[model samples]
Target: MIVSTNDGQFDQLIDDLSRLPTYTIGRATTNSIVVANGKISGQHARLIQCTPTCFIFEDLSSKNGSFVNEVRIARKVVDKQDTLRLADTTFDIDTLLALLKAEPVKAEKPVPPVSITPKLLSEVESNSLNFTEEFADLKQVYEQYPKLRKDCRNREKMIRTGSVILSSIVSISAVVSTGGAALPLLHVLSGAGLSVLIPTLCSTLLSTEEKLEVIDKEYRERYRCPNPACRDPFGTREWELLAQQKTCRRCQAIWVQ
Candidate 1:
């Protein structure tokens, strides 16, 4: 289960909710999930385990009320995929369960601080520089390269959409602020300045070609054989083709399923 805290951050992770037959969610200390938000009543809601894969959400007549997919409900049968809201905080049950099933992260030891001179920094940089364009496992490339491509596409789309919205807002605001009224010279100058700034900001935003160039650079940096010792660039090679090949040309790393 996932719980949103009082600070409006949904960082709390409950690995499993099935452990308990019934779990209470409220602002009170005795509840299973004690959310300290004012919207939540002292005894807000409870989840009663009905079956292995099903649970019943019972709202305790909260002031702000409980919701299942935005509809306020007193009692409802909920599955993992249901969207649950207790007062103001909302959480996806499927997302929470998915997070629980995801691979656990290993704890890392803290690294000690290092005091470095220019010579030491130079030596460190030289030692850390990887000449080979390969990883130790082809699986890494198979998994990560597609995600990189998707991220690039998403970023490009976001930038384009944002640029349009930003330019439109600036243009509209500049027009609306004037309101056809005879403004002071300073106000007119300010409006003119905003007009000048609109194009400048729009021009600064990366074009599709520039975004593609960045993507290409990123692709060159990362789309290599999954062998740290011999990272050969798989230039313009389709992932399917690489998978069919089964092994890296440079590193001989097996691309096992």
Candidate 2:
């Protein structure tokens, strides 16, 4: 789709311009939208089989606006032989024809399709099954790591603490100035310092929580049962099983160990 607008009027005219191509520009062709001199040059110009289709142009709200048949059109499509006026300048219909005729004609070519055989289809199906099994195994590993959820929560808490501190300082300063207090400048400085300190404490606490979460995630991902029968990594309590339990979550088979 092609859209055009004046220097500062694109936003206001975009909706109208969007609806034009759907109605005028037919399917089965490649289209070009041209914007020139702060107005639609050709809004719905299509290349059908490499041949030019009907050219459509419209005006966007402009200081030096568009006029059709000597009538000012803030937004309207123009066809061949349509007189276009911009500001005090006038354009004859033949001028557009000459411009369209100047464009070089383009040749169209046909596209070929490919044929698929049963062997190729079978291989594709086999690869798909292998990918599904690998994905299932990864999902099982991810589900075992509870630290992912904990780390996310801690990061959120840190962001909220920082925002709250900034907001509180701004709010306190506004309230104090509004009261018209005769308090000394030192008092205001102390209040500001206190606000900074509160958020800093909260942020530090959240950061420590996150650091521990990272360590836990790392350890859980690295540790796995060496036993060949139950070599799965433990994650949350839901996935963790007691020692001597004989089920493999990924394969859902009995564990030898």
Candidate 3:
């Protein structure tokens, strides 16, 4: 069964309720019909399968309570025509059920059984060993940090040297060498100042330190997780917690750093 509502809150509310025999409508993450509101209880109301195709909704001693078609119901068998309300959102139960009935059911394709040979087993073992080696590379990723800093320093020095040399040449040509001819002193000084300003702007803006920092950040993100089996991205709440602990959410493997 598929259900869709115009409300942003119930965007992913559509699912096969038949497969989920008992659907709990609440703010809790564990609930099937998750309301995701502060007002609703953790395990608010329960929806039970009465028959093969029939469902019944029952209020589970909720603080806010549940209603059907504006009337507060303690327990009521769901009908296609019924309008259910929980918390702030007013669900059009009749329209949702109609859409569910109209929606076609897709049959799942059967997966073929794996027949592991000696060559395949050898490949699998090789992959497992390579995976561990890849994670070992994460530890050595920071070893390149010293080299990166040195390179950035060298590049900055080169830029500074180049800028100084260019500006010096321009200044000597325009100011020191008078060409033994009648030329305006203001024009010559202005030309030297303009030449120095261009090089100074280029050196300041195209900084090697900024470029090196960007590259370092990219690598840090790439090699965050030490365990290759649990190489989940390191930004989420679960991964953040894992940083303090020795457990990973992806592989459910306990590790020591």
**Which candidate has the top score in TM-score?**
1
Candidate 1 residue-wise lDDT, 1-257, digit = tens: 11222322111111021122456778888876677798899989887543233456789989999999999998876766679998889976543234222367899999999999999999976555332222323334444344434433454343343333334323323322222211221233222212111111122223334434433444454567655676688776776677777666665666533
Q: Estimate each model's TM-score.
A: 0.30, 0.20, 0.29
Sorted on TM-score, best first, the list reads 1, 3, 2
Question: Rank order by lDDT, top first?
Answer: 1, 3, 2
Note the clash tally of each candidate.
7, 1, 0
Q: What does the lDDT come to for candidate 3? A: 0.46
**How does residue 38 of candidate 2 score in lDDT?**
33
The regions of model 3 sitting more than 4 angstroms off are: 1-20, 51-53, 93-257
Which parts of model 1 have CA positions greater than 4 angstroms off? 1-20, 94-257
- How far off is residue 232 in model 2, in Å? 87
| Deviation of model 1 at 174, angstroms | 76
All candidates: CA RMSD (Å): 25.5, 25.8, 27.0
